[model samples]
Target: MTVPAYLHIVQYCAFGIAIIANSLLLHLIRMRAGLSFGRYRVLMISFSIYAIVYANIEIFTLPVMYMQGAGMIFYVDSVLKNHQDIGLLIAVSYCGCLAFCISMLATHFIFRYIAVCRQHHIHIFNGYKVYLLLIPPFFLFLIWAGAMFVCYRPNEVKRDFYRKVIADLYEEDIDQVAFIAPLYYTHQTDGSVLYRISDLLGCLLSCGILGACFTTCSICAYKTYNKLHDSAIQMSKRTRTLSKQLFWTLGLQTLLPFITQYIPVGLVFLLPLFEIQVGKTMAVPVYLHIVQYCAFVIAIISNCLLLHLIRMRAGASFGRYRILMISFSIYAIVYANIEIFTLPVMYIQGSGMIFYVDSFLKYHQDAGLLIAIVYCGCLALCISMLSTHFIFRYIAVCRLAWKMEVYSTEFLT
Candidate 1:
């Protein structure tokens, strides 16, 4: 089969599997653990909504099957006539999905901040704090919806519908000629510019929110993990397990989106400079879909593992959760090294042999030395940062201990 057909099958299958897995895991959590379905409820709901929107886009937009030897062929007959309603539904759902993701991220960071900064504060344990965490995203979504309503004539544009359909249909079979035709047609000035402006604003706002959440969460995670490592705090097994669960879930949650979506999008934006143009644009949609699907799957598995860890550490059934977490951590580290390090090194070597060998020959001695120096410097910097982070965490934990000692002395006096 053609690439498009393969992608279609893969995308749909992954979506189906992820949804089923998440649903079953979530059901098990609720039944076994009397856990309040608070923030996780939002996450699961968002996943379900995204699955429906994504599947609809996949089915409606992509070609059904390919014709043998005729290249990628689309079934034009099954196309929906009134995709306007679908577009609206998708847009609303997508906004909600984004809002929920941001809310969950924000809540995670806020909780971390409270845990680290006000660990002794009794009010911090109050359930009301959870409701308070939802306020920001709720208001942000409302503001966005209001602005979109005021600014855009939703009826005038079919771009979202068209793009969704075209993306699903042609993503795998992406011939430059075929791709550019739809892109040109879609960009034609047919609607009030308000819709475009609204979209731009929404994108900017979402980016800002995500950036803020990521920054705050990174600080919190680094600090918390550092303290834990340095102080060697004899936490209850439950606390240690919970902390690990939070660390891995929130860490992956923050990092994966950047590694997958943001970085790939940035690379696409920089493609103009490379001038090596063998279907570079086609890579974007494919990467976007792959990243999104992978991130969601990882998130679901992480959350499920987290639930299991919480239960197991809190005196439930077996110690299987600890084994699962350890297995996952090992797998993730190995996968990261392979994907991020080994594959990239291989690609660089292969590409250098093919393209850079002749260029290197001309500036052989100087270029080789400079490249080695730069590589070594980067490696040194990474090690230094890691060391500094650990040292700082140790110092902070020591300070906390001193404060606690002083308080104890005063109480005794």
Candidate 2:
């Protein structure tokens, strides 16, 4: 499927913003005095690095996907094209980073669990404890990566492998080796089977670890809260507020990976196997793609707000042009909202309709009328603003104050 141009445009814009914002954030974290210490700092720095690498890969690959007209197709052949080895590595990178993300979250939850339930023992575990815990995932990632590389059989005939992969797309893009081989089967030629087995193993391991951490954290948090509530020991207001904030932050971060990675991956892999129909509107991977763009959107909004705040604080006088600048700002806001709402709605609802002025008007008449009015109003406002600016400039530059005063007096009479 050729991706809609609007989607491509949005993705590019979002990607750009995300890259800048993530880089800035990483720099700030590294440079900030208070944030540069402790277990939290280490984990955050790791996350920032992960995010930067992921964004870099996306920046490189997204344009290729967009230009090739691959749309939302994620098949290895379509995305990687002639560079099959690199493609396989990219796939491995995706899974490895996913595992890394899960491990990070698990570690975070464990820390929280200990801090809440066994604060005295936290020092015993220390920084070395985190290092030990993180090492296993790296080893696991290596094992998973090596297994995936072998599964594709890069040393073998490329054409044969491509055909096999394509043939198996019907059965979730598995090779015959996967369908025919037993779960425990192990052979040099059993690339596909090993791939499936390894994927399942990695996923199971991540889920098990994450689940354990989450359960522990939940129990600890509840117990700690209750214990504090019942105890006569007084906690400082600042301490209580910080604890509450940390609790919510961790809770939100814990939920993030599940929605963005786990659930979407689950649906994509499982839905086909079960032959469940989720309707045309359901695109599980699309959700993941959209989620990837979220960082960019957030960055864009944040930067805009920050700049506005800076201007306000600096007391930058707008003078006679304040109204003019304000008008343009409002116009920009309205225009952005209109396109954001209208394009997505039309594309999703129009049922294969291309996003164009004619198609939209033809398909959604009332909406078209409203849109037309908005366009004309915006154009009129823009022209009026320009005319007002030119008139003022002429009055100021050409010494037309007397003419303005005479006109004002005639209007008053």
Candidate 3:
């Protein structure tokens, strides 16, 4: 089925906002003072590229589906007709996703290796040499590219061979291949066992790498915290504050993706095995899509908070938490009202409002006005929250610098 126009608009707006925010974040990190640029810079760049590619692919592919619906053509045929473009889009997106995942995983492992196996040699890698960091991600890209090329066979192959190839790759039942293959071709199932197999492998690899990284990072972080706690000399308040911010950022980053991707996928897959109705199967995937998009939006917004944490850690004056609280409150109020009112209005008025406006108002204006007011109000509030959070953090960092200088002079005297 084609995506609704409203959803297309929403997706476009979301992509636009995320790209702008992520770009600004990259700039801030580069310009920000006293931040550990070497350690976090690659991570941020990888994530930003991943987000951009993901959003673009969604935006491009949805319209293709929409065109198929409008023309009453087969969706799979349309996708194949546009295969070169679509393939490029998916290739770029998956590459970025792989880079982000592998880099993060590698970073954690390297840190763990240094901490546990070669503590004395840690300083040798302190500057985070770009050449060393790029090696793992580059290898990951090459592997993904090879798999994708193999999976995306030309449309003339026999169905049985295709299914066998896919099943062999993913290790799934031949029957299950039929379900996913329709996505790529019209007469024969696109359920190239190959694509599913590759995807399954990719997911497993990503999970394994991420698991190792998290374990190592957690251990290192805990050890560092304990060591700091045992130190009796009056600890620098700046150091303590910075540690807190870093901990919060890392914790949120580690947890959000699993909640967004794995949990939803697990729930969807489990529902079917439990004998849920076939009709409900679509609901699970649909809901999963929504949840995934929401997660992406939240992750992008959360980066704004990350910037604030970096500023605070750098001993820059981050403005009072009260401002952030107030900004959040304003956003909550606007969002809650929009959510509470929109459904009721849509239900109570129904299509009657459309007819009413067309007949009486002669312009069908009120319907548009209502939607505009609700959306605009919510958007305004979100912008306010984002702006205030970043500004307050900037102020806080400045304050930290002033305090640091004062303490330094007093100690010297």
Each model's TM-score?
0.48, 0.53, 0.51
Estimate the overall C-alpha local distance difference test score of candidate 3: 0.46
Off by over 4 Å in 3: 35-81, 84-99, 105-120, 126-130, 148-237, 262-285, 288-413
Q: Judge candidate 2 at residue 249 and give its lDDT.
A: 63
- Pairs with steric clashes in candidate 2: none
- Rank candidates, lDDT, best first: 2, 3, 1
Predicted structure 2, TM vs. truth: 0.53
lDDT of 3 by residue, 230-332 (tens): 6563546775555545555555655565566445433332332233322212122244244445554564456556455445453424324544554574455
What global local distance difference test value does model 1 have? 0.45
Best by TM-score: 2
Tens digits of per-residue lDDT, candidate 2, 232-337, equal: 6466665555555556566666565666566655554344333342322323324433443443344345445545644564343433444455555555566555
Query: Which runs in model 2 stand beyond 4 Å of their true positions?
Result: 1-15, 30-37, 60-73, 76-80, 125-130, 136-140, 143-234, 276-413
Q: How many pairs of residues collide in each model?
A: 5, 0, 13
Ranking of predictions according to TM-score = 2, 3, 1
Best by lDDT: 2
